[model samples]
Target chain A: MGTARANWAFLLGYRFYVAAFFVFLAAPLIAAGSFAFNDSLFPALPWQGFTLDWFFNDTEPKLGMFHDRRLLRGLYYSFVIACGVSALSVFVGTCNAFLFVRTDLPAKNFFYIVMIVPLVIPGVILGISILAMASQFANGLEEAHGIELGFLRPGLPLVVLGQFSFIATITSLVITARLRKFDATMEEAAYNLGASRLRVLTTITLPFLRPAMIAAGIVAFLVSFENFNTTLFLVGSESPLTITMFDRMAKVGSTPVLNAVSFFLMIGSGALALVSVLVQRDRTKV
Target chain B: MSQRDIKRLTLFLLFAPFALWILLLIVLPHIGMGYLALREKIGPRQYEFGFGNFVEFAMEPIYWNTLLRTGSMSLLVTALALIVGFPIAYYIAKIANYRTRGAMFLLCLIPLWVSDLIRAFGWILLLRETGVISSSLQAIGLIDAPVELLYNDVTVVIGLVYTVMLFMIVPLVSTLDGMDNSMIEAGYNLGGSGLTVLRRIIIPYAMPGIVSGCIIVFMLTAGSYLTPILLGGKNSSWFTEMIYEQFITRYNWEAGATFGFLLLAFTSLVVWLGLKLSRQTLAGTVARS
Candidate 1:
């Protein structure tokens, strides 16, 4: 009876601990989200009544996030860059999936390790290494043959390349996990049924891998959009949304507009995350 | 085309991109960065190859001191995350029902979906002078005046633990979920206390997860620049800040590359030691996470 009572008390204590842990995890985010509607310029307590001026007003002293030209441009640039990164990473990562899984490549273990090296290295190092290589290559070409490569400069193309360098590893992992589950006998059957290699690939294999690829693309897009450490070094003049927010939070104090932006991001990313989870769950059920 | 030709073409197509990706992005850039670090500016248009940049880093007290501070602080963050995360991971893994487990996992992942910038911004809202915590304290008469909580080492550690908590919890949950409740039950049946059962059965079983989670969290905290700068404010004194100052604020690529290499070396060494001590492979650790 004593042991039973002790066990009950322990369980109750454990439950309380877990509850407190979650509150710690969630308090700041909930605070930031709630403050978006606060009428006060500052994101503090004693809420001065709810207002939507942070999201809609275009006038001074209360400019909306949408009306802020820099914020909008940052959002546009982030969207475009995320698109480019997703497309490139998905395509190349698909190729990587095939290379590591399907093809009879020698020293496969070594190559696999090489592929995931980017995943472990710091993003800042990745950015700087790419920057160093590009600048040196550009300078060398100009010095030797009076040639110039505009794409090597810090710009959208470089940003896409830098992001792709690391983001592809994630897409590759996602696609490879799915591809490994694929039954190769299906491909063998396609070949035996007079389907050419290309036809078999396009019709049999790719169709099976389409869901994983789409999921991977979405993951790639979200990662690219939220990326800051690498993009910080690679961005030339056009800052992405993360960089813009970083500048604002570091330089200027918190504004309700930033809170409004945070709320929008939370909703948008929360929805995307839910969709991905559901999609993966459905695939597993099938 | 002949069958052999088609086969050869396919192999070529498969190998080209993989080789190009490693060479152009991973291999060549690192080599270039190393070479840049080696070069010393002797004249306006002339350069010489040497180890002066690395030597300079070693000779500087402030530089190495900041690196040590970053390392020790990162270690603290990793330890705190583990202590804080283990029980939560255990609760989710062992205590929750199957349906609620899914919901709890999603809740943990939600914060990660938001950008780190906004997450740090959230911390600013809660910890600043006129922020929620301070204002609330003032409101309730707990304090006469608001106290600034944003720019200190403790706050930086707290923010970092928050940032990397998900990494620790996911690995911990994945490993703990695989654990059999019977082992824990058996330990209890053998007259072991709860703490003893946890130490003897649970921790040993979850060792790989713990090690992997620690490795990832340590690497992240050590390399992190945003949280330290934002939460630590002017006194951040983080090593990443030094590298950033050299590269961007001062236009000293050589110095920046050297500092970057030192950081990379230190982190790699620690990760290697961690793997060695835990008897875990990098592949297993990374794939599980």
Candidate 2:
């Protein structure tokens, strides 16, 4: 009876710890989501009466949120850049994974180390390096050919390039983790039965890699979207969503509009998480 | 086609994209950065080949101080993460029931799914004056006034640890999951106390994971710019901040490239040493496991 009582006591203590951990993790997100509906100008202290003014109403001069055209543009730019970076990274990363796992490439280990170097290198450094190279290229182009490439002039293309530089590494790692489990004998047998390499890859290997590829692509998009260090250096006058939000917080303190944006992002990410979980479940069952 | 020809062609096709990516993105930029680092800035847009940039970095006390501070802060954060994260990982991996373990693991991962910007902002909300921590303290009469918590090293360290804890925990859990339970039981059965069993059996078994986790956390915290930028404020300057200023405000590419290379070299050296040590320790643990 004493041992049973002691076990119960221990279980209760552990349950409390777990509860605290969950609360700590979830409280901020909940708070941020709730604040989106707040009518207050400042996000700091006293909560003024609840209103959906930030999301819907635009009657007030300084208060209404949807009137902020800057935020809308930033969001649009972020989506476009994220989509581009994701597509490019998925293509390059998938090819890299195939090479690493399935092919007989010489100096595989050496290339693997080189590939992962970007992961260890800081984003700020990568950003500056790319900026320097692009600026130099632009200067040389002006001097030699008397032409200007506006896209590469520390804005959209540069941001995409900076993001893709490292995001591809992440995608490659994820796909490679999945590929390590692949049975290559299937591909070998397909080849022996007169199926070409391209057909075997398309039908067998590509199908196997689809889930990991999707996950990697989503992760790459999110990483590029949320990136600040690299994007900050490369972003000219125009801002990405994260950069815009950060600039607002720095200059004029936090606003309910920021909270509204956070709320929208939270919902988007949560939906993505739900879909990924369902997809993973289906894949596991298959 | 012959088998050899087919194999060669297949290898070329497989490696083509990756080779191009590495060549264009990684190799070419580093080569450019290296050249820029060696050249002296004659003016805003002009350069001449020299080691003046390296000399400038070497001569600057502020640069060295920032580097030292960044290293020490990273070390402090990495140590804190290991201390806090190891127990949770051990519990999830070895003690918890299967159902509970999944939930607990998810708890650890929730912080990771949130953006770092949001997480840092959350810390500000909790730590700033009239924020949650201060308000609660004031309500409890623990202090007469709300304390200033932002724009300091304490907040920076807290932010770093909060952001990087999962990096340490995930690797440790993966490593601990592979450990056998019977060895720990045997230690306890042979007149060993709980502490002895933990210290003698479990920790040694889990050392590789711990080491790898520490290395990863250390490298990440050392290079991280956003957490420090947001939480550290203007007064608390990290080395990366200097690089940012050079590249952005001053447009000093030479100096920025030099700083970047120096930071890269430092991280790579630490990684090399860590790999060497972990390989030796891991060999022993692998034999035992």
Candidate 3:
């Protein structure tokens, strides 16, 4: 009876500790969510009255977030750049994963390490390096050929390219992890049964890799969208949402509009993550 | 040519995109950065080949001080993470029921689902003088006044630890999960106390996870710009801040590249040493396991 009581006490203690940890992890997110609906402009002390004014009401200072053209433009730019980065990364990462796992590539270890180099190197460094190279290339082109590539001059393309340097590494690692677990015997058997490599790959390997591809693509999009260090160097005059938000915070004090934006993003990302988790669970069950 | 040669050629062709991308986008640019770092910043628009930039970085007391600060900060964060993460990892791996373990693991990973920006923002909210933590502490009379918590080195350390803790935890969890629980039981059965069993069996078993975790957390904390930028404020600056100023504000690409290369070189050297140390520790753990 004493031992049973002791076990119960231990279990209760463990449960409390676990709960505390969860609360610690979740508190910031919850606070941000609450502050989004807060009536006050500043994140001042004492709980202000609740209002959806930041989200819906359009006025001079708090320009109804829905109608805020600058914020919308920033969001649009962020989405477009993220999409470009994700697509490029997925393409290159998938190909790299295929080469690493399924193909007979010479000096595989060297390539693998080379592929992961960008990940270890700081983002700020990568950003500056890419910018320097691009500027030099642009200068030489203009001097020699009298040709202009306005898009390449520290804008969306540069942002996508800079982001791709790291995003591709992430995608490659994820797809590679998935690929390592894949049973290659099926592909071998298919080839042995007189199937062409292309057919075997397309019908078998591609389908098998599709889930990882999607996950990698989504993660790449998120990384690019939220990316600051590299994007700061390559954004030029245009701004992504994160950059816009950061600039606003730096210039002025905190605003409820920023909170509203963050809250909406949190909800949106949470929903997407939930869906992905469900899909992953279903896949595992299958 | 044989069929094998054709297959190898096909594979090489398949890998062409990655090779080209890495060679041009990463390797070439890094080499260029290294070269730029050695050059002199002649003007806002010009650079001449010299070692003046390196000399400038070396001569600056602030540079060395920031480097030391960043290194020590990373080390402290790694140690804090190990303390917080190990018990949780141990509990999940060895003690918890299967369902509970899964749930606990997911709980740990939830923080990672949020972007680092949002996470840092969360800390900003919590650690601000008029923020939740201070308010609660004040309300509870823990202090006479709301303390200056944000924009300090302590806050920076907390933010770094919170941000990089999961990096330590996940690797540790994976390593510890692979460990056999019966070893601990055997140690205990041989008249060893719980502390002895833990020290003799569990610590050695989890050493790889701990080492790898420390390396990853240290590297991440050292290289991290966002957490330090947001939380550390202007007064408490890291080396990366200097790099940012050179690149963004001054437009001194040569100096910026030089600083970046120096930071990279230092971090790479540390990581290389960490890898060697961890390999030895991991081997010892494996032998014991």
Per-model lDDT: 0.89, 0.79, 0.79
Worst 10 residues of 1 chain B by lDDT: B280-289
lDDT, model 3, position A135 = 80
DockQ of each: 0.72, 0.44, 0.48
What is candidate 3's local distance difference test score?
Answer: 0.79
Give the clashing residue pairs of candidate 3, or none.
A58-A64
TM-score of chain A of each: 0.95, 0.90, 0.90
TM-scores for all predictions:
0.96, 0.91, 0.91
Give candidate 2 misplaced runs (Cα > 4 Å).
A1-21, A61-65, A188-196, B43-46, B280-289
In terms of docking quality, how is candidate 1 classified?
medium
Residue lDDT tens for model 2, A14-42: 66765665676676667666777766776
Q: Tell the DockQ for candidate 2.
A: 0.44
How far is B78's C-alpha from truth in model 1 (Å)? 1.1
| Model 3 residue B161 CA deviation in Å | 0.8
Model 1: CA > 4 A from native: A192-194, B1-8, B189-192
